[model samples]
Target chain A: AQSVTQLDSHVSVSEGTPVLLRCNYSSSYSPSLFWYVQHPNKGLQLLLKYTSAATLVKGINGFEAEFKKSETSFHLTKPSAHMSDAAEYFCVVRGNNQGGKLIFGQGTELSVKP
Target chain B: AAGVIQSPRHLIKEKRETATLKCYPIPRHDTVYWYQQGPGQDPQFLISFYEKMQSDKGSIPDRFSAQQFSDYHSELNMSSLELGDSALYFCASSFRGGPAPDTQYFGPGTRLTVL
Candidate 1:
């Protein structure tokens, strides 16, 4: 089965500092990758996606991620952190064998300090 | 762009009660997906439908059922709810047949609390 593993359970950073949340996935086929964000008691919002395109994908809210096939990883990064960026981040994967069903990783809760 | 809409943003039910959650997909979207997000847990895929037909299913319990209507709207009907069922239920939609791969757009989710 295809699944994703988030490296950090929680990530804290001071405002204006760089942010990095690691994710590694296991899949038999070329997988579709995505990053979604969830505020407390809110819905999951799409940040970005990787689907056999460019290795680097840019998303909303100044967030981006790179799909490294060699490493089986798609880690999300942000140049600077803001208070509003603090939330739960989920690394998701959808492999062909899964018949397009999305599988989510244990989320990384980001805490941005002022 | 219009986003997926879920009804009864909050629901409270006692054990063994039945709950019906409705989802209205974005305009022109042909697929609908259901997921459950337990507290501090990742969202688990429950079921999905394409063109108002059942397409795929996942870790859904037998006590839970879902179906899509002609209008491409979907509903998840859960029966004999347990305290474990108290979680946020999410509905997502995606458009197929486009040049790009289907990207699921999620709803605000309905928070179900069992007491």
Candidate 2:
């Protein structure tokens, strides 16, 4: 069984400040982790993915996440928050099974304050 | 770069009616996945197809069936639709020829509303 948990349901940060969204996971097999951002009425956009290669993964729009096996965590972060960065963030874990389904976390809604 | 494509961006149906959703994978992509997302909910994996074959199954309801065609396009058919079935249906495509953990690109999901 594979599962992901996002620690925060909502997070607010001021513009130009640092941002963080916490996530954790449990998987029987070595897992593949991903961060996806969904804007209002829009499709999910892949931010970054961790495939056991790099622990610190860099994504588009200056976002990044660190995959910590010991902690079973993959937290998304950014140095500076922009207005456009506000969206719903999902932490996803890919299943090791044949179909490779993606198990998503509950989601963390990020709000950027001006 | 081409991304996955889905049809009927929005749909409305009455209870017990049937609905069909279509998906076209990216060029040369060998795998396609379907996910359902309810309001303010995370996307839930429904099923996946690899090389036109059913590769994995998830929490998909028995009333729903999906298949990948020879052209790599797929269709998800739902029968006896219920209000609970109203959600955003997303189709994702990935190329599995290279390595493990292929990145799946998502399409603009179809918003299905059942009245």
Candidate 3:
């Protein structure tokens, strides 16, 4: 079984400040991790994915996340937060077994304050 | 190119009535998935179809069923609607049976409300 947990339900950060959203996962095998963003009244858009090649993954809109195996965490971060960055973020994990199904975190609502 | 497309962007149904949602995956994609998202929550997997075969099903009830067509288009049927079933339903697709990592592309979603 695989599962993901987003540490924060809501995170607020000022524009131009750094942003961090934490996530932890439990997977039986080497899992493929992903970060997705959902804007208001829109579908989910992929931010980035970690397929065991790189520990640090860069995504669109100046967002990035580091896959930490030992810590069992894949935390999303951005150097400077923009007002457009305000959205709901989800951390997902897919198992390497047969019939791979994505397990999603509870989600984190990011609010960028100006 | 267009991503996954879903029909009936919004729907309202009475309790005990049936509700059907449709999805059209991107051309050439062999996998399609259905998910349900509740208010202020993450999307929950319902079922997945790969090459017109049922691959995986999650914790949804038996009233929820899905089918896939030869062209990879899919439909989700709910036998009897319930108030709890009111939520946003999303359709996703991905390329399967390849070396490429499985990345799902999602549709705008259908908002279903049961009265």
Supply every candidate's count of residue pairs whose N, Cα or C atoms clash at under 3 angstroms.
0, 0, 0
Roughly what TM-score does model 3 have, to 2 decimal places?
0.97
Cα error, candidate 3, residue A100 (Å):
1.7
Residue-level lDDT for B93 in candidate 3: 90
Docking class of 3: high
- Candidate 1 C-alpha lDDT tens digits along B1-115: 7899999899999999999999999988888999999999999999999887888999999999999999999999999999999999999998876554469999999999999
- The regions of model 1 sitting more than 4 angstroms off are A97-99
Once fitted onto the true fold, the runs of candidate 3 whose alpha carbons sit more than 4 angstroms away are: none
Judging by lDDT, tell me the better candidate of 2 and 3: 2
TM-score of chain A of each: 0.96, 0.98, 0.97
Query: Model 1 in CAPRI terms: which quality?
Result: medium
Point out the higher-scoring one by DockQ: 2 or 3. Answer: 2
Writing each residue's lDDT as its tens digit, candidate 2 over B42-95 gives: 999999999999999988999999999999999999999999999999999998
For model 2, residues A1-114, the per-residue Cα lDDT tens digits are 889999999999999999999999999878899999999999999999999888999999999999998999999999999999999999999888878888899999999999
Q: Provide the lDDT at B3 for model 2.
A: 86
Which pairs of residues collide in candidate 1?
none
